[model samples]
Target: MSSAQSSMQLSNVSDPLRVHVPPNETPEERKRRIAAEKKAKKISEAIDKQLKAERDEMEKTRGTKLLLLGSSESGKTTVLKQLKIIHGKGLENEREQYRHIVHLNVLTAIKALAKGFEVNNLTLENSENDEHLAAILSLSSIKESLNRQSLSLQAAVGGLKSADDATAILLANYESVKAVWSDSAVQKYFESANDIGLQDSAKYFLDNVDRLAQENYLPTDEDILQARIRTLGVTEHKFDINSTTYKIYDVGGHRSQRQYWAPYFDDVNAIIFMAAVSAFDQPLEEDLRINRMRDSLDLFNTICNHPLFKNTSIILFLNKIDILKKKLNRLQLKTYFKEYQGANDFQSVTKFFRREFLSRNKVVDKNVYVHFTHATDTTQMRVIVASVNDMIQRENLKASGLI
Candidate 1:
């Protein structure tokens, strides 16, 4: 007998008491109910197991890992520092440490312009136009001046408790340096910005030497932004955004340091590639024959087409737009890149450059996000950084099937 039939009992006392079947459930209906319950329980167990697996994976991987990649001086380090300013720790104290670099930048900018004279074949007095070759080797003092300043700045940064006294002396020495730089023979080279290009910020610092030479002077965000320092190795910065931790890696961009980049390429979630847009007219410091813009494009192409990063996200930062805007009226883009057909204005030129870079992307179906950035501007960086945070989080969540 079925359980339902077994449960039913006849009441003997009530004159032919009826056998009651509770709710009249049949054998087939009971079998179906049991089967349905078992199926539901199995599905529940499977879902719980999947959720547990995902949680474990999430716990192990932590949050998104963002990688910064580009050729040297593409502003990768600056972008990483921006991440520090927005989402990092101990940056306030760290800012003081960068003071020496600022002094060094001013010195390097001056030296770069002075060095241009040699590259352009300009010599000091006593070299006639047609008579004979000038004593080109006598220009050793230009390099010597740079070395002396570098040594002095290093000494000050190491020994002095305050940067003001040493900076004051450096500025005082600048008067004599400016006299040498302003000489008519050297002024001719500055007109065309040929050979080694001088930084636009060089004049800004020179103009305000009196104010900046003070011992109490601290580098502003703009000063730090314009300061150029080549990163040497991999630097990792940590930050938490939207309930997820982010590990951002900034690597050296120099040619020699590129071999170190491959190890970090694996397990990376996204890459923020920086290209110095203003470098269209300038050459790479490592190899003066190769245009900086060309190097940036080549590096971008390699990163986009890499098999390891096929699924990784790419964000292109067209850096130094502020300098580009300033130089448009002064320097012609076509003079450097003969193939550029766009107008001389900022919008047209930037668009042309952007297309030139984007055309090199070999990866299909992957959209590369581009941002025109002035790395020194903290205000603009804050907005851009927040946008990047959102994009990374959304992409990561989708990849993990949490969206």
Candidate 2:
């Protein structure tokens, strides 16, 4: 057989299987098939249009989402609480919730003062306080024990009333706390409380020891605002302003808790980045070697230049200005921030830190609104929050091309 004749034979064998045969359809059947396809197409189009309308409605009704980002003890939670008091319902009903926390604050402050005394090699002025010091230190040891065994600070403190003897210990030794807190040497240590990592509220609580120790004492609004508790995870609060709902998220600022932050980056309209200007002389509780102000600056730089937040409006809150002002009167900013050459006065120091934070923004077009805030002052925060809300609304409108 020739090669051409063999190829022809192979084609004949494969052609039958390769060819596709359509079944014959009547005219009526053809009409029904086309009509069915058109009906399906109409349904799909209607579904798509309905979905688009739903999405538009949702976008119209959605509220502004703001993230409060800051280092631990930078007053983020205080800001949140102020907002709750100003916009949402007042903290009147919630005052009782913080009674134990107020007690804990006193305990924590005294323990820090005691530790400061030990670290500074200073003795209590009153030798009689030696017994009281022992009692206070015993409470400190109990706190440490509860912290180690409990999964969270809330759990540990919550157990203070029932699951543990910390409350009794605290009550029994609160008078001791008062005694140690009043010691001349302890007061000297408290002068550098920032250096010793004492909370900003320590002075307030320690000052009101007698009032707080009253049998039925409830935390006042100021006490609740000043109470320092380390935020463990993410907290959300919602309030309405000018018919627009606003959701504020307060996330833990510790390094360990930072992992929970990225999940909230998406769809965030604004970020309120708080830096404790007073923390210039202090160290981070998480890493004692790193200065708290330096850590805040580094974190601010990262967030300002982050790809995810390139377009997100940023509000820089130089919080704890009151503390910073007091500290500057005694401690020089240049001592901690070596690059600082300005005077130790409040104006010069604040201007320098503001410049430092603004200089970190790599995006030339991005504007960071800076505010010097005292988070505990409700009157001041009321004004700041109003301005912030206006700025956010304007920014959102601009983003949507409505401006």
Each candidate structure's count of clashing pairs: 1, 0
Give the per-residue lDDT of model 1 (tens digit) for 303-331: 99899988888989999898899779888
TM-score of model 1 (CA atoms): 0.75
Runs in model 1 deviating more than 4 A are 1-61, 115-174, 177-191, 197-200
Model 1 residue 187 distance off true place after TM-score fit, in angstroms: 7.4
Model 2 lDDT tens row, 1-403:
9999998898667464353333597788777877887897899999999997896577657778889998887888888889889998988887765776676666766776776576667778899998888776666344542222012357446646542344455678877888898889788767866655567877888899888878788788899898776778999888888767888889999889999999999998999999999889988777789998999999999999999998887999999999888887789888888898878899898889999999999987887999999999999999999999899889977986879
For model 2, the stretches where C-alpha displacement exceeds 4 angstroms are: 1-57, 145-167
Predict model 2's lDDT versus the native.
0.80
Model number with the top TM-score? 2
Which stretch of 10 consecutive residues in model 1 shows the poorest summed lDDT? Answer: 129-138
* Candidate 1 global lDDT: 0.69
